[model samples]
Target chain A: MSDRKNLNRAVSVARGYDPYTSEWLEHEFESYALLREHLPVARTEQLAYRRQFNGGWLLTRYDDISACLSDTDVFSSQSSDYPQRPWIPQAIDPPSHTAYRRIMNKWFTPEAMTAMEPHLWDFAGELLDKMLQKDEFDFVADFADPFPTVIFCELFGFPLDDYEQLMDWKNTLMHATDGHSAGRALAVAKAKELGLQTPDEGELPSEVAGQVYGATAAALYEYFGGLLEQRREHARNDMISQLIASEYDGERPLTNEELLDTLFLMFMAGLDTVASAMGLIVKTFAEQPDKRREFIALMDDSQKLTLAVEELVRTHAIVLLPRRVTEEKEFEGASMHAGDQVMCPTMAGNRDPEQFENPDEIIYDRVPNRHMGFGHGPHRCLGIHLARRELRIGLQLLHQRMPDYELHPDKKPELFGGMKGASSLWLRKG
Target chain B: MRVEIIADKCQGHGMCNMVCPSVFKHDEDGFGYVVAELAEVPAELQDEVRLAEVQCPERAIVIED
Candidate 1:
């Protein structure tokens, strides 16, 4: 068959299994492996297979995706023409995006993250101690969820008591991958339920369309208004306060809107990505005892935990970076048009056989490890240093305290919903 | 090892000076201007140097053997 005919056939086969169908679990698993094998770059009807908003093209090939990430000129980050959610700035192209990023970059540096380490360790240790008392607990809900949640709360000076509520909102937002509109509706609904008016469903007198547009702006205005006020009065060594004190263009500081938008981005970007990664890390370590032991040995020998954290990120890349095509571009002979959205799957990119030997398997000491877990180029994750520290401290303490931890065989991990995480990863503590 | 600073990229982040004051001192520009070179770094200061390297916002400084 001709290439076009072959492409058509492949697309049909891909569409045969709905990417969002929870009932198609077997098909989804088979497709994940099959797509990687067959058309690693083939198109699909999967909403996530393409950019959710504009039906733009998605590129799964490792090299093409990386190139897209580095080449920001052809891709725009502005949400002006595209249909996007409120917290989409991090995924936008650069230049304009850089201003917002600059406002909050300092708070996520290694020094800032290190300063927050004591609090993170205390939180992780407290959670682990409680889990150890039970000796067997759901890893995702009991451990993975709380690790990033508490760390983020303490780091930003937000109340730790709000973690569960935040997690529910986050879950609603992230797990809507399949049912994009419905999922987002549910997320907005949940956000409203939490007394925060979402753009889609706020109690404004405006029309539904206007409400959708104004809800996020209004809610954020109110949320950060209070925060900005609090920080201006008493600068509490937290992220919000730091940003308030920060000067841009040698001016006073970031505006209230900017602060709220960034904080919202932080919440959207942080929670699930780390939680998913933690689940993957625990699951991977549990499955491969030798590798886990090797990680422990590396931590013990180096006494510097960042190396292990790097290895963990390299091994299981959680978030895939998405970019939009601004002009007609051809990558590897595939003609991509202007306005096509491309996703650089960091997991797939990190596992490229050309990049790493035995790409599918985890290499505990994968040296010369230059993976795009945080991404490459200017728009890389601002909070990467902080995330790395949290991962290092959380993993090290967990291993040291509960050395003989294992996945509980009674409860098989259910990888359902829109998340690629184990629903309930039960573990037996040492 | 000597530490070199590329001033053009430096945004006066102050992270380097905060991390390793002895090894790096800020100039009038407010950016970190490396002031010292040591062939052998003390054991206590190793973490400080590593932290400085990791914390540099502009990635303007390079430590070489």
Candidate 2:
């Protein structure tokens, strides 16, 4: 592969292998496979490569990706220290990460998430009912986006009315770095259009964009603060109240900053990741009706739900875990510097042929499944249990309620952002 | 038997204290830092300790027999 000097040869081969260039995000899957096939880790001198975005190291091999995640000390989660509102805690490394994570862990446990099953099911059911009422609806807007957003709102004890506004803010925030000037400009415009004003807007004119960008932060902080105050007076039976009442290290109460940051992280991370995954899962099932029927059949058998959920996560890993090298190290013969960023694309890792048989195909009952869909080691997704519970309950309810659903032929599914997942997947219910 | 926890891995999910409250306790960080090591394992609490092992989401605890 190295002897072939023509780079276009590889690109041409990739295009032939995956014909859906128009619809796919970055032709990422094809390129990932090509890179893995050619060299497990290959360097690209592409001008589009930005240092901040994974620092140009894309670990395409499964073992290499897994090794990076496990070695958290050497490979830090502090991918960038740029001053921006931290909407996700997974971006932070240990020590400080420890405290913030503790406050939020209560909300994401299997037990906590299991309790949310009924609510999530109801959310899915209600959304599906609305969709079934219409002849055709945008799957991303009507179902995929709303399902996770509503769940997140409920989890944070926020009003359901704020779902649309929250979704728009999150979308803008995630794609901010792609086109810095344009993205920031769009964010400011959105804030104005939404009639949302930030608290810091009055004090610091220089940081108006920062303030505007962090308006959601202010809103969240105020919301959580009110709940915390209420909980301090008298604890409610909700996750917010539980967090407010939680004692860190033992006797120390969480600071207001810690509480708000943790809540914001959960809200932001939960929205796109789960929604995108759900969209892809539904799209995958729609594309393969046989697999859809098989999944439905498994749903009928109570014992198979866990296996089905595992397979779904494995098959459609949307979020790529990004890590930075905290120490100079040699990994798989590559000399990684202390500041270099490594993007562990879970989708690529999960689909490595060396790890699983027929890596691309969705085997609904593949046992001994150890995919990094929820990630690995300590920094693994805290909300994974909730994500699984939500997915399992949502899918089960969806299959049971609308077993004969099919994708609308007229509408093409939009892949969300640069992430390897669907944004919208329109389906017609029978 | 006593259990030692790597503090860094602990997220203070409270599975340890919830399972074996007599053995494990939360520290200043809201995480379960080791409290005490029991000399003789009470038969009743053995299941509780095992429950802690399974329930700990972080997998930060290791038990010494």
Candidate 3:
């Protein structure tokens, strides 16, 4: 087949670009390469109908994605109306985004993260002790999922007892389509609240998934709403209470709706991304022993470990940031219309050849590594410092417990897309 | 070289602080700011300061020679 034909085959959105499938995951890098070379801004007929918006342009190069993210006025994060409730700071543009960010930033600073390190280390050790007891286990389910989720709960002041429930709700909201079977039962239960009676037996329709997400989200809002009331009465030294004590633009207290919106955003963002990153990182290590050894070597050295974390995150970049073009204009030979959805998949940008030398390879000490795994610009990940701390502690403890881990020969990692990670990563220690 | 962070442009990615903690420190809100004690980028720390300037995703860091 001609290179162009192969490129077309790889980049065709109509071919059902299901990220859950190994085929799609395998083609992803090749497709990114082809798109960057021949069509940096390629239009898609559909973008996984499961996504909030479909049929838009995909920006596959580093500079273009960076430009799109940096130029927030033109490429707005207020992209979709799907969720209906806007995630504060994430969905809100400028002035408002700034104000919202300010209200929450202090709780996630490097100093706060540093203060939380000993607790994190203890927690990681606790989890690893339990995990290493089993000869073989699903890393995503066993360690990765609970590690970040539990830490986030502790930070947000959610009862540690509710951690399992919180994880189920999150999975229902975010991983329903990714074959997370645990989410299915919870989705059905939540679906009842939405008056949705058993959404068939097999694959949930996109509409049903939307309804389930809404129902799950409402549960979270109510959960946090109650928590907010308690914090209002008597503030605790936790993020929720801190947010309650915060002022918006120094003018007034944040509205209940605003607080809920922000918490909702935090709930989703805090629980999933770090866990997803851990899953991806470990899965990579399981498949590639040499990379694992290199990473293990850096575990004791904080400086080298920091650089290693950046590179692993860069290579396994999961976010596919969507933006709405605010005005019609020509951009890099593509005629973009106002309100058109544009996807800036950070994976493509992180792996763009023009930006990084040997873009696909994970060089633990890649200098000047300005990869946007946590994103860029005003809406960058609020919990970045916490995330870095988590990765460092998580990896350090994991390798210390099981230095010779590998992918289970019988079971394979189920790669998920749309804020990508393995839904299930089976591993065995040698 | 004197270094400063343009507070308006900083969204608190903290790359400046990460790359050069000697010159850059984060506020309680994680926003990067040059250390008040450091009136100038010390000769020893200039290279790290330059890297911080380059690494600031928001381009909020500035150095005047």
Candidate 4:
């Protein structure tokens, strides 16, 4: 039963939705329903500072979002502000994207991901053991955050010791704001204007956040540059080595910049996404014991486990996919111009009532659940197999180790929007 | 039912192969394609073939009776 009050708030948010305000993040599903029903082509002018687009249309309905994702020619991934440099494959359009993808497809196949299962299970068991040692611990910090990040580091050949520092960089890049109280006040005023909660402010302060973000990116480029050189000298059995050995378009080796950019994308995309998914999903389970019990009952059955992971991912879909309009066109009753932005919140599309019979309900065995959780079209997540394996293994080991757990009464889970994640999720064993 | 993956639409999400590996296998580049011998789904796997068809995010699978 959707709350009418939430729907009213969502309607207000749709009218003047600002990316920086975080209002839409709080009541996301309600916002999705209201926008999909009332304003299928919702428009917002308040752009994030680093974003290039001045104004954009938000597509809430599944069909519209899917159509946008599929038509790469019309809705280009080259929407990033960083035109001088782009994340390989992701920001590239076909046939270039196709070529880049060809080089990578074999590496992320279901078979390849399946090979990593034993190692993933072992690592998850180790982490879960450490986590269960404490009666009450932060799920995000203890299990969710480190579990995926460590696995990603091992795969990418990054040092395990640098995970903390790398996470700081990622946090700064993804979540940190200008840190200006004036800006925060303005955003709060805007949220108030929309009759929403106070905006979730970034932890880091002004100039610091920007500096850390910039420095972190530069450090990553430099770090990868050196690693690539070492791999070139004598290739190891790691992703960096694999990239070094693989030819680009069956031509020459990829340029240093290309290698660096690809690694950069990998670092950002691989590190935090699954961790966020875990945080959100576990938080959901902690709050809903019935769902937790259902999940635990199905844990031993592989097929049911797979479907459960998919359902959890569908319900907790996190990415807010952005695209650029390459040419002027009339789309879904909205006039999209060349150079305009299109925000396709997968979270919204995954929950659209028009697409699913009961959009909000998490049906573990929901078939044809072609949800946009991993996105759609050519830009579908390259790590889909790995992500699924990680989520499944993570859930399995978590429930096996601690069958019954609940949120800590004193500590609260901190959820943030825009590639939404839980910064803090404290859980206690029963 | 006989099934085929539309090449142009298949971006290799590999959901088909995951759903029914016996019927769906991927090429060297990992894009899903019907196993040549099993392109015509066995009676026992007909349900799985249909599941794979709908699970495909790209809607690349075309099934015929």
Candidate 5:
């Protein structure tokens, strides 16, 4: 069916593609065709987690998503989190944000990605071998989850033993459904039990949700804040240590809080994104055996393999970033006012027919794939290089070891509300 | 074929490098530039160069024949 029809259906459909709605739960991108056609700048007062104020327009069209992302002045990425606090470069607007990004840019450059490949290849093999040893295992719990987390720990010089704790902290704070963390109480079961509907912008059951988020966030800060101080005294060859010694504004070193904030942003951006991408990649390849074979045939050629990964990234695009309107403005016939949170669905944008020749279908070796999977403009994903590296090597290793892997008989992917990913991907190796 | 990239418009998407490596290369900052000293596309790689021109999100890559 035409996505436009689905989009119109959303109007009468309960939970109409609301991030927390049952309609969205059924499928996130199913209604975007309608959204892009009719509601390029549609406004609503309902949201899943953040209900501070009535919502602004949700930009679903390809051009609109790009316009909002690139227009730094009108659509600012400044801290939209309630009880406003700095979130490093992400929270800061440009000129200043450019400087902070510059400091961290060198850490994730193409050169750095190349340098880390050998290490990543060995590690991916190590993890895949371990998984292959097991006849059947939850791909996520077995490899998809811990693989990136462990790599994250090694990259930042965080204590290796604390990887589990770090994952717990991250999953709890980032992944939530009802009033509890999906990591702890389990989001799917909670969703089923509560059948939670998307609350109006100001109608969120915030008291409990706020406390849960606040408690989790505080614990993460306390843990990482101590690590920053320790790094200051005993610096090492890790990104965390690099951040600690780096200077900004002038010769003044970054404050402990800035360092902590920056690290927090990196944690949220890096680990879950890669892991989620891997789970989907593995799951998709497993289901489409012929497509998997086509991808494997290109595995020996680095250039083609890289292009395949880009196409896969486009097909399974994740992340729904929200930007706040800086002032009253007219954009593509949609009027936006200051302080309105504009939800930009990059995942939907990636599938826009105007951009890709066959946007909905995954085309391996899709040349010139200008996908917004990493987003656009200055605030574009700082970890793009590193993420691409992880996906490339991770998939390469998976196909090499378990060429015939497929999803377990009874299990399907567990997709979250806002972010699209496979939380539970059960696999059986051939 | 001659080529040029509007660096300001280039968000460093890196599609140019993927499409025609011999024609374009991303600098240290991850932005793209014509790799040939003359900023000219070789005839042998002309097809690939056109491919990148289409792929660039910013439409930063331009080709003149």
Candidate 6:
């Protein structure tokens, strides 16, 4: 097949050869390199119901992605763009987004991180100890999955007993093989993966996926809503209580929908991203012993460890958000229409050669590194304090407990292309 | 040298604190704040402060001599 044909096959939004599949997922950066060099803003029709569903322009360059994120006016994040309900501050923009952020910002403040540091350390230590006690362990199931999940649940006041199942719901909705399962469930998931903000009712997300995701969403809403009301009645020193009690501009406070949507966004965001990061980072260490040693050397060095966390995140940014053009506009040499889906491939931006020296390398102390791992602009990650602290403490505890470790000799970790993460990673301690 | 972090642009990316802790410290919100005693970057830490200025993702930190 021609290079163009191969790239097309790899970039397909709808079917057979999507980025998440082996055709593109395994060679993601190589394909992204091609896309960046030849077609910075390549457009692709989503495979499923191409007629009814709209395709989008994939923004691959670092500057373009950064510009679009910063240019909120032309590229809207309003909930209307999504087929489903809005995710509070993530789906809102400007004054309103800023205001919503201010309320949650208190929960992620530096002091909050400082207070949570010991707990994060404890979580990391406990997980690492269990993994280290044995010579063989599945890092993904054992550590990556629970560390962030537990911290997120604890900070937000979710019942600790439900951690495993909440994570299962997240995995089911996100990481299932494309188009492989029951109707609506698979379609909603695939449509989501394809960055299809709005899918025609009959086009995809068969009735089952809708019901499945709907049930999951409703269950989650009730879960958080119950907590919000509880907190409303009896406040606690947790994030949910703060959010429930949050008020601004005397606008009669946030409605229940607003709180639920915000919690929904938090619920989804907090569960998977960090686990993905840990999976990818651990997978790399398993493969690259040298980098692992280098990382271990910096375990006690706060400055170096902090910088290393940023660099690792840059090397392996896991989240890719979808934005729709508000109106007709010319962006990065592409003429796009209103209501067009534009995927901001943050990970691709992190690897853009124009943005970083040795862009593909894991330079532990790369300085002046302005990578968009946590994203950029007004809607940048609100949970960065917690994310950073988790990364640092997680790695510190693991390396201290199992300094010399590698991938299980018999089994290799499974990785996905989109929002990359290991399905399972087997590690062996020395 | 005077060092101040512009609140509008700062997204609490802690680069300033990492680069020059003496001159810059993270506030309760996790955003870098100019340390009161060291706002005027001491001669020894001036270079570090400049590096922080260049490295700040939002370019939030400004060191004015």
Docking class of 1: incorrect
Candidate 4: C-alpha RMSD after superposition: 5.5
Clashing pairs in 3: none
Shift in Å, residue A261, candidate 5? 0.9
Candidate 4 lDDT over A77-112, as tens digits, reads 987654237898788999988888888889888988
Q: List all candidate RMSDs to the true structure.
A: 6.9, 7.9, 2.6, 5.5, 4.3, 4.9
Q: After superposition, how far is residue A147 of candidate 2 from its true place, in Å?
A: 2.2
- Best by the TM-score measure: 3
**Higher-DockQ candidate among 1 and 6?**
6
* Local error of candidate 6 at residue A243 (angstroms): 1.2
Lowest-scoring 10 consecutive residues by lDDT in candidate 3 chain A?
Answer: A13-22
Task: Report how far off residue A282 is in candidate 5 (Å).
Answer: 1.9
Clashing pairs in 6: A14-A47, A110-B28, A110-B29, A110-B30, A184-A206, A184-A209, A185-A209
- lDDT order, best first, reads 3, 4, 6, 5, 2, 1
Model 2 per-residue lDDT tens digits across residues A1-430? 4536435555444333321222345566676787676656544323113333433466778788878887879988867543344544677776666666766665565455566777777778888888768876777678777887777776666657776556666655554323223334456575676665634222212244454556655655676677678767876566677777777766687677767766677766778777778888988888888999989888866446666777788888876676777878888888877777677778888888887778888887664456778776667777776677677777888788678867888876766434545656777765
CAPRI band for model 4: medium
Judge the docking of candidate 6 as incorrect, acceptable, medium or high.
medium
Error of 1 at A181 (Å): 17
* Full-model lDDT for every candidate: 0.62, 0.66, 0.81, 0.80, 0.74, 0.75
Pairs of colliding residues, candidate 1: A77-A92, A77-A93, A199-A216, B1-B38
The superposed Cα distance between candidate 4 and the true structure at residue A402, in angstroms, equals: 0.9
lDDT of 5 at A145: 81
Error of 4 at A78 (Å): 1.4
DockQ, each predicted model: 0.10, 0.08, 0.59, 0.75, 0.45, 0.54
Per residue, candidate 6 scores C-alpha lDDT tens digits across A1-430 of 6878866654553233245432456676876777787678778665212223355777778888888888888887761323257887899888788788877776786556778888888778878777777889889889998899998998888888887667656665555443212323444664476455545443343444444556666666777777888888999877888777778544667788888888888887888888889899989998999999999998798878878998999998987766777889998668988877777778889999998888999998888788888888888888887888888888888888778888899987767555667767898886
Candidate 6's TM-score reads 0.88
Off by over 4 Å in 4: A1-12, A19-23, A48-50, A178-211
TM-score of each: 0.74, 0.75, 0.92, 0.91, 0.90, 0.88
The docking category that best describes candidate 2 is incorrect
